[model samples]
Target: MAEEELKIEEGGKKGKLMIIIIAAVVIIAGGAAAFFFLGGSDDDMADVQAVEGQAGAAPSASTGSAKSGTALYVAMPRPFVLNVPGAGRDRLVEIKVQLMVRGSDSEELAKSHIPLIEGTLLQVFSSSNADDLVTEAGKIALREQSLRDVQAKMQEIAGADVVEEVLFTGFVMQ
Candidate 1:
């Protein structure tokens, strides 16, 4: 009977030791995981700072301001009305366009040269075919062409690409 008691005590001690070791391993693994997830390395912080600095310093053509990182849109004073020729008869197309500019200087330049820009845009619009304007691809191509034309003219006057995109605010074909 004493021998049986001794064997039970020894088994109990072994089981307790195994439980303690497993608990210790789990606690250590949890601590390591928390440290890695919560404490991001110094390199990550440096990369974030570098990106913020570049955003402020670089001249962004898409955004209005390097400091604010916002887009600036300038609306044309008047809508453009052009006669688009068709196979049977000519159709009148009216469009309202807004220019997306980057900086204050570009905005001012665009405002000042509105007349010249309007004339250039009108020339491009009037040359389009009425049939082509009915298609989605044709409209997209027209918008692209307008952007190129406006940017070219702005570049000539401002010595840089002032306009980023030409957006059609309104389009009517009659």
Candidate 2:
């Protein structure tokens, strides 16, 4: 009987040890899977940089245009608020903008000239009619005009098209 009890105890111990080993392996595998799934990628890093108005690096001098370097977005400090003339009355409008640029140099240039750029954008936005702003085509036209005016101003100041695109991050009219 003593020998049989000892053998049973040994078997139980071995079984418990096997279960513990399997559980440990499963836990380790789960942890590794989570780490891989949640890992950061290059595109995520680029988006973070764009949000912070910083680009990876400067492109070569020969690549003088906005398309030649890494794309980044510089957000304006404040939303533009104005009144637009409507058919019946003036409507209040608010527009938030971000400027897309290429390269670190263009990002820095845009950030430094925020006030001028804001003024130019405000002028362009305020010129829109409330009826026109309500339409998709009108919004596209406004965006294009804003881009042109901003690029022209930046070109005159920085001697290059520092702003590539004018993005309307937010728009509200009432």
TM-score per candidate: 0.63, 0.68
Query: Which candidate has the highest lDDT of all?
Result: 2
Instruction: Give lDDT tens digits, candidate 1, residues 39-150.
Output: 9999999997787666663354444342332357899999998789988789999999999876566677778889989998998998899998989898999999998898
RMSD of candidates 1 onward, in order: 9.7, 6.3
Q: What C-alpha lDDT do the candidate models reach, one value each?
A: 0.82, 0.88
Q: Give stretches of model 1 more than 4 Å off.
A: 1-53, 57-69
- Model 1: clashing residue pairs? none
How close to the true structure is residue 112 of candidate 2, measured as C-alpha lDDT?
Answer: 94
Error of model 1, residue 6, in angstroms: 73
Worst 10 residues of 2 by lDDT: 53-62
Cα lDDT tens digits, model 2, 1-174, are 999999999999999999999999999999999988999889998897785555325653245567756788999998998999999889999999999988888898899999999989988988899999999999999999999999899878778888889999999999
Q: How accurate is candidate 2 locally (lDDT)?
A: 0.88
